[model samples]
Target: MTVTEKDRDILARTLWGEARGEGLAGQIAVAWAIRNRVDDGKLKSWWGEGYSGVCQAPYQFSCWNKNDPNYAYLSGAMAIPFRELAQCRGVADQVTDGRVPDPTGGATHYYAIAMPKAPAWAAKARQTLKLGGHVFFKGVP
Candidate 1:
């Protein structure tokens, strides 16, 4: 697969119904799981940072697990890539660095996004932004 920017955009549009901001963020989070997190690599950081920027937190996927409440709430939603609906609802610790079996019998990649901004993170980002923080997000294919 080429996995070009255009491909990402189309995939986002197809999945999310619209095609930018939180909508694109939702799909890109899924793609990030498939592209960078499904395994592990320098590319992982790219997706992690991208997810964090859009959703407004310093999201890191490795920390998510089934034991956590945040993970439980986010799993079903991220698995299907919803819009800003996943935004700012707590530590939305969605994962984008693993795979799960498909109902049809296949393993699919995963990615995560966090919501409601965990206290530590929200505080830190708030402070930084207060001091002038610059944020950026990747464009989908």
Candidate 2:
């Protein structure tokens, strides 16, 4: 549970990529989902090793995908807006440091409400929260 700077950076970038438009609360929820994955003892293998591992794991968060529009910014190939990234970094630090309560209610998965249709997995999972433009869920099958 020792979060390194790499972990913080990756988590911050992930928040920036995934939920920047949703603002601080939304970003915090997303961060908790990643943290939940990191802290899940039962599914550790599936989620990868830690914050960086889980964020960069293949096909989990679409922003990490090479073809995604956010990839360049998230990967540092393109510069992210300073104020936005700083806000995301603050959320990342608070979430990773256990300073913020999980608004996602132990959610390990989420999808933008703007999607044409919810992901198939969402049907099997328990919905936790609906905040900003996303829906949070846990116990995804």
Candidate 3:
């Protein structure tokens, strides 16, 4: 897929919102999850068309949700930290260009360990990786 600047920017913002505190490895894992969705032929329609579409798909990434706290910064209502966003941008570029390896082992789903309770879907999902504050999974039913 030809990733547009908007795609890269949204992907970077997603990484910043979702995994900025988790550092480079965590951000990479999150990026791979998005990429997995982008590359999955089975659920192409479900995941939206490409990077931008997938990231902005309704209720997919919470950072894009209108009520989400991160939405303010992601939508430009607030400002993001320059250094952190820059790092996320670098990770986004690498992952989208296929330079970074799939650290989540093809995971298409993940949730932070900080959540009060795991999401219901996680119980039916096969766990693929556990890194930083998030648990990665695949084959979710």
Query: Model 3 compared with the native: what TM-score?
Result: 0.97
Please state every model's RMSD to the true fold in angstroms: 14.1, 0.7, 0.7
TM-score of each: 0.22, 0.98, 0.97
TM-score of 1: 0.22
Runs with alpha carbons beyond 4 Å of true place in candidate 2: none
Off by over 4 Å in 3: none
TM-score leaderboard ranking: 2, 3, 1
Q: RMSD of candidate 1 to the true fold?
A: 14.1
Off by over 4 Å in 1: 1-21, 37-59, 62-69, 75-141
Displacement of residue 85 (Cα, Å) in model 3 is: 0.8
* Residues 40-80 of candidate 1: C-alpha lDDT, one tens digit per residue: 34454444323332222234333234454445334443453
Encode model 2's per-residue lDDT on 13-62: one tens digit a residue: 99999999998889999999999999998877788889999999998999
Better of 2 and 3 by lDDT: 3
User: lDDT of all predictions, in order shown?
Assistant: 0.30, 0.94, 0.94
Q: Write the per-residue lDDT of candidate 3 for residues 96-128, one digit (tens) a residue.
A: 999979989889999999999999999999999
